[model samples]
Target: MRQWETAYEKWKNDEGLDAHLKQELDAMHDQPEALEDAFYRDLAFGTGGMRGVLGPGTNRMNIYTIRKAVNGLAHYLKNHCVNVNDRGVAVSYDSRHMSKEFAVETAKVLGAHGVKAYVFNTLHPTPLLSFAVRYLGAAAGVMITASHNPPEYNGFKVYNEDGGQVTPDEAAAITEAIQKTEDELSVPYLEQEEIEAKELLTWGGQEVDNAYLEQLESITKLDADEQEQTKDLQIVFTPLHGTACDLVQRGLDNLHFHQVDVVEEQAVPDPEFSTVDSPNPEEHQAFTMAMELGKQTNADILIGTDPDADRLGAAVKNDTGDYAVLTGNQLGALMLDYILRHTDPKLLPNARMIKTIVTSELGRRIADSYGVQTMDTLTGFKYIGEKIRQFDATGEAFIFGYEESYGYLISDVVRDKDAVQSAIFACEMAYYWKKQGKTLYDALQSLYETYGYYVEDMISLKLTGKQGSEKIARIMQAARTESFTDIGGVDVLAVEDYWTSERMVAGSSQPEEIDLPQENVVKFLLKDDCWICLRPSGTEPKLKCYVSVRGDSEEDSRKRLTKLKTAMDHFLHRTQS
Candidate 1:
């Protein structure tokens, strides 16, 4: 209680806080729970970076919190760079509350420390920011977005010079710097006008867009004839009132898809995302308006991208005359097959596809059939991006990369998952399928028949607030301590503990090292090509369990999945209790 009082006094006396934060603090002065929630602990920097609810607290995603993060980043950059002033940071944001403000604040903080800042003229997708960082040879990048989080949520993602999210080691160094900054207000910020006077701040525009688009085009395997035949294919797309409107639509047009229909209601950017309960395209509801528009146009395919345009979702008409939303695994496998089949083997003699370990192994089988290599990374797109960066450094060809959570990257143009490129590819593939007198669903069915049936599902258990955080920690600990030899009546062949960087094969004398960076994740490989992974969400207080199974038929796959899900649920309940 005494420590809490002291912290409150310091906050009250702090003159550097924004007026809104001060007001909130005053209103919550008598509310102990609110204050504790707000200041209980500073937001932790994790694999991808900081994300949280938007509010007035150290744990929130407000200007002060953003400044603290930037201050730490600035310190790290200055110390590491020989020419600190010349090394700038690229900034981009999405259509979320205060997203632009956060971008500007980040720029101001960078400028105050004598670092140049290059900011987008307006809200842009997160992947574009990653591209700009490497394109401009900037020291780092900052993207103000929560990816597909709910309306009330926002976040700050930091990228290193490699255009990948800061590696864990780099993040730890930045975290140390942030902790050294005793007061957030002590961090200096340059006024917008002052930054412009010194020409320290630059705006990204058509030049960057042109370069990015050209690179996006290079990834296409479409021939002149294919483009001509597919140009008139009817396609419906929605950005979900996010940042993908212009880039994705224009990319499709460039790909020669002439009959693209944009969902006008969602074409314009809206911070509130008024049309959908959540802007996440993974949810079928996010595509409601677009699906309706698709039906009206008799479109061959419907597509949606999240607010920041880093993730993509699609729906295709099924044999039942109803729209079936394709799972991320299904979409990824389809895209991988299409790209591999269309491209000449000579061009990609060393071509490769990448996906997270928890993603469907069906993709691996598909790649194998095409004589392409498939690599599995830990469960974040950043890991995929890291592999892409490695491929770029070497001479390996990166054909595609995706995760099971609706995020995908089709081209190496942008290091991160790019909905813009995925949108174009999805439309082009839909057109090709339509030319064969079939829908995307039909294509999926054909693939399933060719390969064995594969099924995957995710279960996320939400635990909110501080207590929830503790409980999540306990759950992870319990999983770490326990050894399950069997699940769903199948033998557990091996356990991969990412946090400990160890892979323990059942009955093995010793564990092997898992080369990926350490994170709080565990995966158990079961017999019969089935597996399950458990991890806590980086942005939210939730435990995410992923299950996958392979069977001879769709029905068999469903039965296996049902049994596995039930077993998982029983374990979850027991642990929680």
Candidate 2:
């Protein structure tokens, strides 16, 4: 019998399994392919923690997996944390299926080990969980969410005491601790009554909400006069049936923005996310309801946040007088430009901005124009948060950090990508430009005119199941070994293999070491300073290809991007086959 078959049988024969999981197992007895997919291997847990579809399998997100992960976190904390008994874990959840259940179970698991659990009384956004860790002085934090993933998906993200996602070393240690559990189903947990009696579980949210709002308020660079002048700027906001309606509304109110309109259809907390195909703001389809409302209300701008409110997306009237969603890269440049232009001159000398390797370089150019240094980290926002902590220690100012996937961090108080703060800031920026008689889209055009036109796009190809995982590995290997002189008629200048942390130029036989951390990524530098990068998604079963090109005009940039995308897609398809 195969390994997966053996594991399937082991799970099938266990009479002590949870009732719902047992029912699911019995229903899938005759479905060999489904069984294999579920039992092929354990759901991966790494720096991003564990994320998977919700079901009854080793590779699924269930109560057993959540327990096992929390159990391991508890073990790792005991060994590494100081005063673990007193400094408990802070827990929060989004409006996903079983999110509350998972969070409550996480607290119970920690309570079973005599550690306290400070959990939010109700669902909150992911960034607030990051803030609660430091606000409550907890040892660590757990956010029960899948961010912007589909309704069937869920995740568990771990955070360090410093309010950022756990570092790679700490994550590895936690993974090691998790691997020692022989049986996930047998992990012990305290009941709600038992935990409460022992003072192991504490529920709070309003205080944290107020405190977080205060911090958000303090980060506004605009003075009272400017804020008062911009407060009436018409705006429409949507939370995509997730956990940002209350806080974002309250936040805008604090900013004295009285003309804000909320998309009532998507403001309620919904586990199914019924209105859209997916809750992600990266896709334009997610803004359908918001756009309609924007048209009816004649709003100046439209903003939407994903389920957990960690990513923000916006739509502005284009040259055609229709709502057009701005790409993450374009929004990043806008925020960076507005922030740098408004920040105190004395602070600019010590200020720094960070972006992922795959993000557009237009922000870098803008930062350079302002004399602010720009740093690039690997593809995760955790690295950006880690840099913020480092800069805090070294006395450097972290002005802003963003990813091309619509995640942005405006203030370091909330270590993760905060959509709440970014949403308000984006509105402020829109108003700032409006005062100058320009729309946000108009501002983007002006930016392109000042700096060169830069266009970027990401192609995500979903390759799922065990076979797909193998194919992704093979594709990465092929990218490293294959020789290419040019792509889309452009000469290849260099090849950067992030896995080896080395760059090989066209003429240099010697490879230069990269200053960033090693990751499973490769970049092909092309002529005219354009590039293409390939990396597998850390939290999902997909391979992402990012292409960036510069041009003298918008048409030129779009044409270059199209050619590069066509070539890269062909390469990926050929490799997969």
Candidate 3:
């Protein structure tokens, strides 16, 4: 018998797989490429968790695969805990295909392993899962979401006890445990009724939602009166058919932004995300419907959230009354400036902020101007969450946290990025600007004037499927190996290799430690304040390169960015060739 056929036969003989999966296997019995893609290797567990295309395979995010991951987690918890079964885990999911099912699978696996599980009764946002973990004092949390991925995709994100995504060390431990598990079907799982009867499964719904919303309210700087005056401020919002519609709308209402309008067609939950090609809010095309609604309503601002609603995107009326989509950096800088200006002095001294190193340095300058200390972490909200936890432990107040990819966290109550919080804050900012007879575009331009024209752009080189994965790894390796002396007529002053945790200065043999968790990333700082960073996307088969340049004028900044982009593109193409 052929190798794949024999393997397929063995898999068919297994009793652990349901008829559905067995049928799928049978359908793909003759498809060598599909089988190879399905079982070439197991889906890897990275720092956050395992994420992949959902299908019936060892390599996909199926029930069996999820069960394996949960069993590994359960085993890890058991080994580390004094009372393995009693220590619980919280679970939540977004409005992706099979997200709720995946959450239930996770809970069931935890329950069967004698670990208690608290699961949301319906679709929930990713940030709430983080909040629920800490609120329930669980040992860990699991969120079933693919964030802004296409409808064909889904994922799993694991959080530590502190309510942050799992760190490298923790993820490594779990990955090791997952590797030790031989057969995914062998992992135990409790039936839903049995788990409920045993009192090991608890349903979290309105009670947790109420508490989360209450905590979200506490993060607001605008009072009811301020919101009352600005309540009529016209705003358009779209959740892109994910999980944020109700929470974001409710939060805005509670804040008294009564004129907030939802893009009705896109507001409803849709696993297929039929309205848009992709649900990512960062893309201007994703906001087409929202922008149309904004224009119709004469809305001052247009806001969008990804499927899970942890990240936010905005568009504002420009000088000509046409809508202009603001980058994450622009939105963040505006928020930082607005919050600092209106907040009390007592809040200033204790207030601090964080952003990923790849995020715009403009935010740092804005924070510094207001005497707010800002720190940089490696890419990912997990590091930002880690910083928040450290600050909370040391009595330092967290003013804000964000990444360049539109994720922001305004409140400490939720350890992950909170789009619900961001939506409210953005509405308040818009209202404040409207009361002043100014637009958010005007505010952004003011920020640019003060910060000296900063522009940031990201390029993602997509590699799909198994072959794409190998290419991505090769690209990262190639970037690390190559040396660039100059870019866009600017001399490279330093190269920060995150994987080695070392920064090599120009003309210096010695390297300094970066003092952050080590990861596979490289960043080059140029002499003219232009920078480029290269890193692989954790959730997708892509290598992301970020470029930031600051100039004395907007035109100058654009020119510099274009030059840098062209040079980088040529450089990348040449290297790849």
lDDT of 1 at 265: 91
CA RMSD for every model?
1.7, 1.0, 1.8
Lowest lDDT 10-residue stretch of candidate 1: 223-232
Candidate 3 structure quality by residue, lDDT tens digits, 23-59:
8888987888998888777888998698888878777
- By lDDT, the better pick of 1 and 2 is 2
Cα lDDT of all candidates, in order? 0.86, 0.93, 0.86
lDDT per residue (tens digit) for residues 417-460 in model 1: 88888888888888778778888999999999999899999989
RMSD of 1: 1.7
The TM-score of predicted model 2 comes to 0.99
Query: Model 1: residues >4 Å from true position, as ranges?
Result: 2-5, 228-230, 347-349, 392-394
Superposition error at 246 for model 2 (Å): 0.5
Alpha carbon deviation, residue 437, candidate 3 (Å): 1.3
